[model samples]
Target: MYQKKVKESNKNNIFKYIFEKRKSFVINDIAENLNITFPTVKKIINSFLKQNIIFERQKVGFGVGRKAMEYELNEEFCYSIGILASSTKLKFILTNAIGKILKQQIYELKSNNCKAEILNSTKDFLNTISPEVRKKLIGIGISVPGIVSEEGNFIEFSSKEKIVLSFIEELKNLFHIPVLIENESNLAAIAEAFLTRNSIYSTFTILTINEYVGISNFHQDSLNNTLFFKAGRLHHMVIESNGKLCECGTHGCWGTYVSDKVLLNDFQKYFPSIKTYNEIFDLKYHETNIGASLIDNYLEHLAIGIKNILFFSNPEKLIISGNISIYKEYIADKLIEKIYKNHIFYRGKETIVFSSLNENGSIIGAAMFPILDKII
Candidate 1:
């Protein structure tokens, strides 16, 4: 029985490795990369081919002898649904086994909507998924801007909505598949890390600056080692001893000065018609006095928070993610310059970079949860 379990585990690992590659891989390559025996890998590959989980691809010539056959995941074999719930919108993504997003949808939710209304809309959305995709779905992963209880029963959403346990239960009943809920920032970090599979850094932190500021730490080999630093409540972390009052009944929280809402509020005072961050950047490019000043202040506050995070954890890399990352080219250099100027200790450290996953990081990472859970 123990030997059978080990073989099954090995097969699952091989499948996960192929899915991550997202391309054809030779049997020897899989064995070499995963450190599994060639015979074991070949056995698994043959089994997957028979099960239609993977298919043989065109042979690739390698030096001499007959060409080697490559195997690639059958992407449509399984599917996952990822849902990201934020203060303003609920975003959905359907992905195949290898994490390729097949479809996406977004729904705006009123802040005042009751729990029942929210659930009803979510159910309706689920019902609309393509029957073909729904047929192969193995699970659903939800990324919320808040924490979920260990039992997966309760959610403490950032919007402070009364998202009851019954809501999760309803989703389970509706989908009839395993459901997992996790913090949005954590999911984003996972997605970013997965995409950067060759990155040398084993420990990194992801800071998502959107309507809210969220932070999540990650350790590549051992996710359990990643610390939970009360990411959503970062807004309550006092940056100023006697600063302006925050919604969390705090004074001068870092989030108060470094969020999308704050940036928009400050920019509108200068040009009342400017509605988006892109517009703010447009004014900054033209060097408007208010735009320059607003950007400078935003960068300074961002620097302070980043400096603190660096000193506190000093991870190998710090990834800046979210809608704000779209403007990274404009802000990254200035933010780094400010950080070095204020905290010279990190002047030469390769600690910060914008997230490559962009806004899709959380959704992709959430989708990967069901797949990762089975293999990892």
Candidate 2:
């Protein structure tokens, strides 16, 4: 019985490995890459076919022994729902196992009313979607703007608002499927890693500077999700001995120096005419040194944040994200330059990279949970 179970597990791993490499794969190539006997690979592929987890298509290569049989994940096999609850908005997306969006819903709400707003928004979102898609969904992934529990519960908020944990349980019970909840920063990092599967740099950290500064890390082995989330709640890292007071009563938390609130406050003081971040971007074209200085000063504190992670996790790369990052070009290089200048010995050379996933990284990360669920 144990041996039978082991065989089954091995097949599952092979399937997962192929699915992760890309959206599709060929039989001979999968066997070679997974280092499994050709017969075993064929058997596993047949099993996946029986389960409707994968399907095969004939492709004529430039030159091949026979028409190659290309195996790809069945797009209709399952679905995953992603909820990105941000400080200013709650965006919901329903996607297939491949992270392709089938539908999306967005709602604007006050940050202070997060708990109630999130619950209402989710309920309404489900109601608005087609029943057929909802029924096929294997799981729901919630990416909250605040800290989340290891058990997939939203526990705390970024600002004064609190994240209601009960909604998670409610969704699980209502949908009758697994529900995974995580911090939005963690979701962004996961999405970033998914897009850069070709890079040798396995460990990565992503910081999103939106209405709040959010952080998360990913290790090479893909087990970094939970571990990094536990370590990156930098509400109080104590980077400066005599710095500005933080909301958490710390002398110099990273958030104190580099949060959206601080930047907007400075903008209001200096560029009082500017009403919104979008307006500033449109009007200034980000040419004003004053705004650049605000970003530079924030980057200084951000460098300290990266330094702490470098000493601790030693990630191979760092990615700067969020709404601001999408608009601000050359931000990643400037951040790395600041870190190298301040550090005693520069170790993170060419390790920092800009995020390619853009603002949708978090949502895509949320979409990955369903693919993972189907495999497990």
Candidate 3:
């Protein structure tokens, strides 16, 4: 009985140590790190390997002793699905426990018939993945353009009766898996926060500049805290009482002045022939004249809205994502400069960071949501 209890104690300690590292550790490293004997560590690891609870990989070193091996938590045993929906398109991606993408698909969408199109797209994307893989899916995480409650409820008002009525509810019934819905900007903020090495921001704002700008503030107790989602319609925040008309039925709304739509409009006025943003981005000569100056102005306009958010949230970090995040160095400096100019009392040196998770961060964040939730 004493020997059995001792073995159990050692096993528990090994498990605790692995989680504390938050990253993979080799056998010798784990043993030394935990102050446990090598033989004991080897036995525990071998048991875990046989049970397929952990994965092992070969490691090489020049230190002469037979190069030790490395081990990490196996992800293939679990699965998750992430869906990112926007006015222009929808991205569906599959991932495993280690946050590796197994497969993904992007679909062009029409805003007019969004509900049916979104549902069909979801089904089609899921169908593409093998049925055997689908059986292992534990949950689905969705990133939508508008606000969502803490429990993954869609609170933002919509037009389609099917969606505005009970689309999320129907999906839950169909899938019979945990479905988590979140604001797109909220996902972007978390992705950018994880990418930052400076600090884990519990309170921060994320600005995503697509055709229209979407903003959201994230407030949480810790890195593992539940995310608070608040709608930040900077585009609808009035800049001038009698300025340009906005799509949200408000005159002089910020969106009329500081959205990607405005940039596209500017491009049309000058070039008259340009059809799409991709075309504008692809132009070579635009690097000197139109592209550079337009991007500069867009940055200036974006700062005005960010300044407003700062006044309220006083967030320690501001993350910028989506297509606009590509020109981060240029835009970030511009936003910081304008914020300093507009708010003299803002002495707090909040770190402004860019998303290193690529343009598809929302999808990855969504995919990781389920896996991390289970592991934690």
Candidate with best TM-score = 1
> Model 3 over residues 34-147: C-alpha lDDT tens digits?
788999999998887886657788775577767668887665767888988766778888887545688888898865576677678878887887888888787888877666
**Order the candidates by lDDT, highest first — what do you get?**
1, 2, 3
Better of 1 and 3 by TM-score: 1
Q: Rate the local accuracy (lDDT) of all candidates.
A: 0.74, 0.69, 0.66
For model 2, how does the per-residue alpha-carbon lDDT over 75-157 read when each residue is reduced to its tens digit?
A: 77777888887667889998887777888998999546766786688788778777787777777887766776535444665
Candidate structures ordered by TM-score, highest first: 1, 2, 3
- For model 1, the superposed segments whose C-alpha errors exceed 4 Å read 1-8, 62-66, 111-114, 151-153, 162-166, 197-200, 222-232, 283-286, 342-349
What does candidate 1's lDDT look like per residue over 1-376, in tens digits?
0001212367766875886786778999989987999999988899888878888976866587778888877888888888887777788888887668887888787655645444666677668887877778888888877766555556767645546556666777765887877777777776765666424466678888776788887654433323222344465567898987887777898889998889888988868888876677774442776677888998999988888888887767888888778877877888888988746464354678887777777888889877766554
In model 2, which runs have C-alpha deviations exceeding 4 angstroms? 1-8, 50-52, 61-66, 110-115, 150-154, 159-167, 198-200, 220-229, 240-242, 283-285, 373-376
Q: How high is the lDDT of residue 183 in model 1?
A: 79
Give each model a TM-score: 0.87, 0.81, 0.76
Clashing pairs in 1: none
**Models, CA RMSD each:** 4.3, 4.7, 6.8
